[model samples]
Each structure stands twice: as C-alpha cells, then as structure tokens.
Target: MNWNQIEGNWKQFKGSAKAQWGDLTDNELTEAEGNRDKLVGKIQERYGIAQEEAERQVDSFAAGLKH
Candidate 1:
C-alpha cells in the first residue's frame, strides 16, 4: 500500500510495524503518526541503523500490508 493508505490505516498497521521492530515503543509510533519519514527516522534512531537500511525495511514492511 502507499503511504496515504498506511497513514489512514495506521491504527491497524501499527501492530505489524511493532512486530517488525519490537524495540519501538507505542509512544514513538504515536509520534510517528503514520508518516513514513518519521517512522524511518525513529527506526534509524532506535535501531542504530543506516538511513538506507531503515528506509528499505520500512518500504518492505509497507509493501507487505494488505490494502
């Protein structure tokens, strides 16, 4: 799904995101507020990964969701 869809359905999809990144807190996810860039940045910060890797992971996660 596209970012718009993800944003709109964030409440449902947040669980999937948490599954993928267990270290992420609910508050951080709330702060991300379904924005792709914010999620990527939070993942990068929490996971200590490179921006590219974070983007790739987020892209993959987003792609796996059913619309």
Candidate 2:
C-alpha cells in the first residue's frame, strides 16, 4: 500500500508491524505514527540494521498490506 493509505490506516496495520518487529515497543510505534521515515528509523535503531535494510523491510511490509 501507499504511504498515504498506511498513514491513514495506521491503527489497523500497526499490529502487523508489531508482529514483524517485536523489538519495537508500543510507544515507539505510536511515536512513528505511520510515518515511513520514522518507522525506518525506529527499526534501524531497535534492530541495529543498516538504513537500507530497514527501508527494504519497510517497503516489503507496506507492499504486503496491499495483498
């Protein structure tokens, strides 16, 4: 799904995001507030992954929501 759709429907999809990234706390996700950049940064920080990998994962996660 697109960022607009994701942002608009953040509440519904955040559970799935939590499932995918269990290291992230509830407050972190809430802080992200459906912003892609915020999510990427959080994932990167929490997972100790490279920024590109975080973006790739976020892209995959967003794409999965479309199906």
- The candidate that achieves the highest TM-score relative to the unseen native structure: 1
Per-model TM-score, in order, reads 0.96, 0.96
Instruction: For candidate 2, report its TM-score.
Output: 0.96
* Global local distance difference test of model 1: 0.95
- The collision pairs in model 1 are none
- lDDT of model 2 at position 10: 93
lDDT of residue 6 for candidate 2: 95
Q: What is the lDDT of candidate 2?
A: 0.95
**lDDT tens string, model 1, 1-67?**
9999999989999999999999999999988989999999999999999999999999999889997
For model 1, the stretches where C-alpha displacement exceeds 4 angstroms are none
lDDT of 1 at 33: 88
